[model samples]
Target: MLLPLSMLIVAPVWADEHPGQAQLVQEVAKDTGKDPAALNALLDGAKKQQSILDAISRPAEAKPWSEYRPIFITPARIDEGIRFYRDHRALLEKIGAQYGVAPEYIVAILGVETFYGRNTGNYKVLDALVTLGLYYPPRATFFRGELKTLLELPDNMLAGPLDTLTGSYAGAQGWGQFMPDSIRDYGVDEDGDGRIDLQNSLPDIFASVANYFAKHGWVKGGPVAARAQPDAAAKPLTVKDSAPQWPVEQLEAWGYGPLQHLDPGALSSMQTFQGASGSEYWFTFQNFYVITRYNRSPMYAMAVHQLAQAIAEGVNSPESATQ
Candidate 1:
């Protein structure tokens, strides 16, 4: 879900004139009562721009199943996944059962975001947020708000200003890729140690992730999506900005039928993805939409869904006993 901010730097804009930058400093001072002098000093010499502008400005890679599939469901990833599950099976199972989110889905998220704790970013979160908030005009307002929230974070939760400045290029830090606001709001002290250290604690990371999904209205035992067939007479459904709409009965009335059995009252949204066999269709439900909230891409959501299913199924397979 992290969009590269380097793409926005080449638009001939200067960092000093953003209205939100001043507002953010004021808001931070007002909200956290922190001495702005220290923060100002920190910001004064920070890099004003990213050097990766040309790298980010390139057109986004379209839905390339062949290319994207390997990133999430590789054999090595799956193997490491098995170990992750075994190591944290107790906590993961408890959280998954409580949140109605599959442990595999949570594992896939960790895998996707940080390679299961192997590559948790090298940029300081403070510097990244400050740079993007002041210079990235296309999303300056959003990043500015995040920067204000970052400043308001408890000192105990933060890396020293320098350490926080070096984590993710866009300011998302920790194992779950939480922005500072999300960290403050959704983090949980799963270890019962009175602290939530997402960067190094697996228990805290998994629990925080479950807490996030629960807050986002993840339904227990709800269907994420199902394959379906649309009648030739049915008018094509237009996908606008990846929002899910339409119920099962309405879709049927419009010439869509479930490829697998589905209840008439089930909520659904028509979704199409390019596959090697051609275009594939599915009726996505609320849980699927929840996945999109984590990353606003259907491909990303679908990848998580499929990888989760694969991991769960692989664990339960008869051949799994031999391993």
Candidate 2:
């Protein structure tokens, strides 16, 4: 998610000329009671990176499932995930049991977000937040809110100095790509070190990912998704919404039947994606929706689900015994 800040479209804009600097500083200072002068200094030092603005406009989530699946789910990534699991099996299992989330899911999130912490990001968190929050109009409000929360974060909660911290172009920090709000809300200090170091601490990273899923209502042992086998006379369907409001029987009546036998009364939804083979249909369940809470894109949720399944199978496979 982090690209080098290259090609400055124009001279860097300072805080004096930023559109919403005064109001943001006032609000943050009032809310956190931090020195207004210190906050001003921080913003004054933040350069509005055009690269950040450009990156936000073209998110990978915009890609189709066929194109998106290969990026995160791959043989190399799966093998690495198996190794990561083996390296952290005891901690992953312990957290998974405590949080009621599967260990594979926790690993899958890290695998997708940062390739298991290999690439958290390089953009300065301050500049990224400031550029999007003040300069980008489409999501200014949301980014500005994130900016404020970052300033409000207590010293004990952060792993390093604020000015030096780096994250995604969207200002998400740590292995799980947590934004400021998520850091404040779901971040865990699993090591009891009094700091939520998602970048360096393995326990914090794994537990935080598991905690996010658990808090979002991940159903333990519930199915995430399944391939659908539409009858020749199957009623044509499109992905209208991701919510699992339709009963399994209802989708069956609509001509989209799950390949695996599921409880006919269970609530589910159908989604169609342009796959490599052809149009592919899937039956998504409640656990599938829980993954979407981490990333709104259905493709993202599907990729995570598929990767988790792949990694889980690989870990237990006899072939992995040699790994």
Candidate 3:
């Protein structure tokens, strides 16, 4: 029997280009309650995006702190943090109270993560997540989890079409570079408009950030970090746990004490930073570890802390907010 041309259906060339991705579509669809065909179609549309893999392999945080600090702790970023705090002062304060995180940490998270929403990246979040989810093996487990989170988002949770969604190469989205999973778990609709818009909602962004920190156990009144004058013969240390492995009194017995006054028994993680000046020994408190929970890097936490401090100084001085 001869069928009309309209009866013919063509298979998409992009479909099943990577067999594992097809399997992923099935798995994510099953887990997230999305239609398999719709999920497969979405996965098929995501380009390989080798650039994402490349970018992930060489994250700036991999650099020594000496080099990494300057990238984020610029004078301009401090000024921006001050200005950002000033602009969103009320919301930051309100959210800070609600979440028990300080306003400066929220501002610093935004300033460090996306320059206060000025550069949230141009790569499609869908592409970055899907590419890493399907192809990148080393971090595939983490990316796959984030992908599922994105898949499970209610239609109203998204800012726009998935294809148009864009963020960092690593698939971190919004003004705060939250991974997809964090978006769902910590995102807030501060405006009470009934939708969480991480892309355009500054109130939501600040709240989400504060919520993340609070959930991570950010100590409201605890010291974050302090400069330590370690004995010349003292060996460096690498952090292994969130709690301080070394107590302050013990470190002092070893000739390392806070240059600033603090409780002698305060538990802390010791880390060495390669500064432009020289190697500096430091003791990081519970709040510092809380910041590290955001990125799992000592360098990142220090940079954010240092930047926040600078911004705080600028805010108090009002003269250094010149930029």
Candidate 4:
């Protein structure tokens, strides 16, 4: 359920409360045709959340792959993803087919993002955006743009009343944890109910995720990532170079051969992780980069890939069939 809007900031505030707030109000009003008074009321109701600032300063993506992988790829998470897939199999499969994305990858996104919606977030969307947009100097310009976008977005694209909407510290909302721009660009109303309710509607949630991937060039039935057996003289790669720029043949010539049979001409890149056994290397493909578009971290994409693989395996196992 949505929490009540903070009453503390409900009192009317003028443009003088924060720097450039007046310009924001005027711009949003002109751009979106929203009532300036209502916009003021909404903006006044937003309280600065220091937690959001602190949270963004230390994102999970900052961690090494070994540490980051354990946070999302666990037995319980995989089990829950499998159950979610089974329960929503038909819809998942349909949406996956429509968008050319695999169902387990969709499920893995939900698992990693919000544990299948069990924890969409506790921060109010307004507070998260406002605090970061106005106070957080590092990315204030970006977050401010998001704050304006949130105000400008149509009601049909939102999950609920703007005052009560809750999401992550970074201002990402609903099941898929989309930011304001992502919602505007990629949100789907798969049920055709007029409103794109990412919170309660499974079709909207599933389809929105798939649509984002498809628009971002997720190849149908394409390989995501493959473990590579690096020869004694393999070239090293920093995490920064994870984009699929080189062909698999080029990587092979550098002593990084994929454990699986990937097309020699396929574009790929290498990512080295600090795993339990020591430094681990993997050849990442186009779909792997597509996953990174959701969260720009090689470790994040790897975790999703491994988790999706686990869930797909569980779905196909005889044990799952008996249940």
Candidate 5:
């Protein structure tokens, strides 16, 4: 399931003292030019459910590399990754060249997000988005904006209310787990079939992933991360929310330096991951930050990177050797 983005922030909710969810449904209807009464009716049963609101307002989990690394790089996942690449080789290559991102990275993201479109989710998107937008107080504004976007989508884009119900928890739908707004903004009809279908269209999904990376400042042919060794006298640095805030020069001044094999001119940020036994250091480049845009977790970014590498290596290896 696509995890709720609200997990990044949490706030309290007061139902009785507020304008009530009825007003929210009306607002969405008004904004989208749909009938207010119809929208209100659609939300009648949905508004009463508090469990969805409760789920959206919870804090996100922050796991160390020690635990996160193993979850994504499993043998089963690697095998699937190889199959994904082989199946979509042509489309992957075309999209990769167009966007200047590696095919493996795109494959890894799809593998991680929806298991190559095998498990998009079972939640109703309208129910999830409306529940979060109206009842979840912390990130209500963000989700409400998403709700407005969902309502603005052309009637044809939706698979009717019934088919649209099945998606991720946070209302991210289709292969790449794009939120409704993202689908509108970044999705592409790569197959030239006159429709953007991330659910069943491999070309659209591939293009959307590439488009997302390009928009997020993905540097073509750039290294994602490089091994780094800090001097014995250097103090460990802390990262809040897996963001790359520190510059490469600052990291070098602090006694941590990138590996000799990496280019000196690369723009890099210091990253320290807590392993089970000790700390692991690396210099993350722009491509690394691009992965974080999908999910703002260093562990997630690294897992995707490693999985992509594993997939590429596995694909090139002898078939008998891999088996």
Candidate 6:
């Protein structure tokens, strides 16, 4: 998930001197074939952004589903989401057909992440990566790997210069807010321009998002989820893993079922959530689990699901909305 970086605090402690710079110089310079001194100098300009450390400690994902629901599932966001879906009808449908992911889920993802390209932050990507990579030892190895991949990206692919590049404090960027490695692996030239520009390219962004979900095992023309009710004889759910682990028959045997019939042996999971609307029970299909791959939180998944449902219900002929 993308963390907004509008409130970043610039700290300069690590800019002038970081003992680890020497090792970084040797490692990155060796990989990139650039001069070690140049690499070191670039890092010397990277400040240890204290805000990044502070921000990571309190991510939006940490909030309970009750509070988190209103943040993304608002009228303004939903209205804007409908407009975005209407504007990009054929394109979203085309890619949706290609990737097996529904359009609304893709649109909901964009809506939740940056309000459809309106708020991709202003933090320098280099500083964010460096600050998190060197000083934040908990995830330093991961951030350092992200930093290495960011350095490897071509200038054409970046939103701006490495030193002045702007993105999330965690270093994800562009319309989809992809991490550096995600861009490298899932990024595609949907426009066939021989370059993938996530910043300005809508086709690339749509395809990239679709590619991400597809790679994570999104099922085409399959179920996503359904509201469930426990029968009078229902037993306590023993399933532990978050994803779809038990068969529909097993869940049914325990006295849970959807309003409509499902393949008795199909894989799914029973989820009990304490949301803004109070406790709700659901049977999530495999595709719902795929949405969680984009953001691991169940709240995120539920918001996406409900938003997509709202969009889908509104999109008949009178209006359009992506899920």
Q: What is the lDDT of candidate 4?
A: 0.89
lDDT of 1 by residue, 1-323 (tens): 77566634533322365555556667778888877676665555455546432323442336376566667778877777777776777889998987777788789888877878887787656657766777677777788788778778875565344434455567777777888877888888777766677887787889888888778878888888788787789878887744557768899899988888887887778888777777788888888888887777887878878777777777667787466
| Off by more than 4 A, model 5 | 1-31, 45-60, 159-163, 235-250, 318-323
Model 1 — TM-score against the truth?
Answer: 0.86
- Model 3 earns a TM-score of 0.90
Candidate No. with top TM-score: 2
Off by over 4 Å in 2: 1-11, 237-240
User: Which residue pairs of candidate 6 clash?
Assistant: 104-322, 104-323, 105-323, 308-323
lDDT of 5 by residue, 102-179 (tens): 999999999888888898876677767766777677888988888768866766454345224557768888888989
Clashing pairs in 4: none
lDDT of 1 at 54: 34
Clashing residue pairs found in predicted model 1: 123-166, 123-167, 124-165, 124-166, 124-167, 125-164, 125-165
Better of 3 and 6 by TM-score: 3
Task: List the candidates ranked by TM-score, beginning with the highest.
Answer: 2, 4, 3, 6, 1, 5
- By lDDT, is 1 or 5 better? 5
RMSD each, Å: 4.3, 2.2, 7.3, 3.1, 5.2, 3.7
Whole-model Cα lDDT per candidate? 0.73, 0.88, 0.81, 0.89, 0.76, 0.81
After superposition, which runs of candidate 4 have C-alpha atoms over 4 Å from their true positions? 1-14
Whole-model alpha-carbon lDDT for candidate 5: 0.76
Clashing residue pairs in candidate 2 are: none
List pairs with backbone clashes in candidate 5: none
lDDT of 3 by residue, 69-88 (tens): 98999988987898888777
Q: Per-residue lDDT for 150-246 in model 2, tens only? A: 9999986776999999999999998999998888999999999889998899999988899998888889988889889999999876566677988
lDDT of 6 by residue, 302-321 (tens): 88888887776666545342
What is the alpha-carbon lDDT for the whole of candidate 6? 0.81
